[model samples]
Target: MVLKRIFTAIGVAAAAFALSLSAASPAAAVPVDAPTPVKSRIEAAAAPDTAAEPRTCRARFAENVNHRLRAEAGSAILGSIPAGTWVQASCTRVAGGEYSACGLSSDFWMEVYWKGNWGHGAWGCVQDWEYTS
Candidate 1:
C-alpha cells in the first residue's frame, strides 16, 4: 500500500511540473492584449498601396479575347469580347497570365470593366496585348 501511494505521488508531481512548464511558454509570457509590432509591420507591407489604382481608358481588342474572373488565364471565363470591340476599361496591368501576341510577350493581365458593373459577366481580366490603342 505504501509503494502504491509513492508511485501515485510521483505521477502527480510530474504532471504538475509539466503544467508549470506549459504555463511558462513564450506565448504565455506576453499579455493577452499586448501590441504586436512585428505582426503589424508585416500586415502593413502586404497591403496594396494606392499606386495599384486602375486607369480608365478605351481599349480595342485586335481579336476575340476571353475575360476571366481573375487575372490568371486559367481562371473561369466571364465573357468574350469580339474582335475590334472598343471597351472602356478601368485597367490595372499586373503580373498574371502569360501571353505572347501582337509581336510581344508578357505576363500582364489587363483589367476589363464591361458595361458599368465591375463584377459578373463582361467584367474581368484579359491579356495585356489584347488591348490596342
Candidate 2:
C-alpha cells in the first residue's frame, strides 16, 4: 500500500511538471536563435538603401557656342564642349555660376565628362528644356 502511495505521489508530481511546461507562455520559451530587439528591426527597415547606385545622368551644350567646363562648380575653366555635344554627367546638381542662357534661372551645375576627364558644367533650363522625358 505504501509503495502504491509513493508511486501515485511520483506520478502526480510528474504530471504537475508536464502541466507546468505545457501551460508556459511562448514568451517564456527559449529562443532557437538569438532575438533581435524591436528597435533594431525598426531601424533596419527605416534605414536608407546604401547599396543603390546613383542615377546615370547626361548633358549637352545648349547653343552653337562652346561652354567652359570647370575644375569645380563655378571655378577655373578646365576644358570646353561645343554646342549639341552630349556628355555623361552626375545627376546630382549644385548651385554654381548664374546662367541666363536659354532662359535658365537655376544657377545649377553638375559634374560632367569632357576630353576624357570629369569637370563641372551648367545643367540649367537649357538642358532641362531640350531633353524630354
Candidate 3:
C-alpha cells in the first residue's frame, strides 16, 4: 500500500511539473538582440510580354536559299528560305529560340502538300522571314 501511494505521488508531481513548464514557456518570446530580416534581392522577371508587337518576317536571300529550287520530296534541305515566300507562323513559346507551328495565322496550322511525304519539321528551321524579323 505504501509503495503504491509513493508511485502515485511521483506520477502526480511529474504531471504537475510538465504542466508548469508548458504554461510558463512562451512560444513567441523574442530575444534581446534579434537579427533583422534580410530583404530579398531577387524580384520577379518582367511579366511575360503580352502586348503583341507588329513584326516583320523576311525571306532568305538568294545567296542563302533554304531549299533548293527543286528539293527532293523526302530529303531535309537547309540553307535559307526564298524571298516573297513569307508566311506568318502561330507563335508558341518564344524563349532563346522561337517555338511555333506553321500556321496561317495566330492559330491556324497549315498542312503543306509534299509529294507523297507527310511530317513536320521538328527542327523548325526558321525561314528567311523569321531571320530578318
Candidate 4:
C-alpha cells in the first residue's frame, strides 16, 4: 500500500512538471510534419509497389470473433469490424480501384491490390453491404 502511494505521488509530480514544460514551450518547437527519415523509410518500404503492376490482396479468417471460420465476411463485419471499414487484407479491386468486394458470398475474399503484391484483411462494409446475406 505504501509503495502504491509513493508511486502515485511520483506520477502526480511528473505530470505537474510536464504540464509546466508544455506551457513554457514555444509554438514552433513541434515539427509541422513527420521527420524526414520516417518519410524516406516509408517510401523505401513502399517502393516495391507500382501502378504498372497489379495491386491485389486476399485473406481468409481461420475464425471470426465468434471462433468460427464458417462465419462469412458479412458476419465478421457485424462482429468486431467497424463501419465504413476498408481493410486491404480481405479483398481487392477487380480492375484497378474501380470495383471492390470483401466476399459477400465467397468464404474466402480478396480486397485491394497495390503493385504486383496482394494485401489482406477484414475489408467489410463497402457499398455492397446490403447484399451480405
Candidates in order, TM-scores: namely: 0.43, 0.44, 0.21, 0.20
What order do candidates take by lDDT, descending?
2, 1, 4, 3
Select the stronger candidate by TM-score from 1 and 3: 1
In candidate 4, what are the lDDT values of residues 84-110, reduced to their tens digit?
333334323221121123333223223
Clashes of each: 0, 0, 5, 17
Among residues 3 or more apart in sequence or in different chains, the pairs in candidate 2 whose N, CA or C atoms overlap within 3 Å are none
- TM-score ranking, high to low: 2, 1, 3, 4
Better of 1 and 3 by lDDT: 1
| Candidate 1: stretches off by over 4 Å | 1-55, 100-104, 115-133
Model 1, global lDDT: 0.52
lDDT of 3: 0.34
Model 3 residue runs over 4 Å out of place are 25-133
* Cα RMSD for predicted model 1: 11.8
Candidate 3 has its poorest 10 consecutive residues by lDDT at: 104-113
Q: Across residues 1-133, which tens digit of lDDT does each residue of candidate 2 receive?
A: 9999999999999999999878968777766887433311111222125536545656665653234555233466665667777777665555466555444444555677778777666555234321212
Best by TM-score: 2
Report the lDDT of model 1 for residue 86: 68
lDDT of each residue in 1-133, candidate 1, tens digit only: 9999999999999999999877876876788886523311111222235645443555556557676677665678767777667666544344566555444455654566665534211222232222222
| Model 4 Cα shift for residue 39 (angstroms) | 40
Give me the candidate number with maximum lDDT. 2
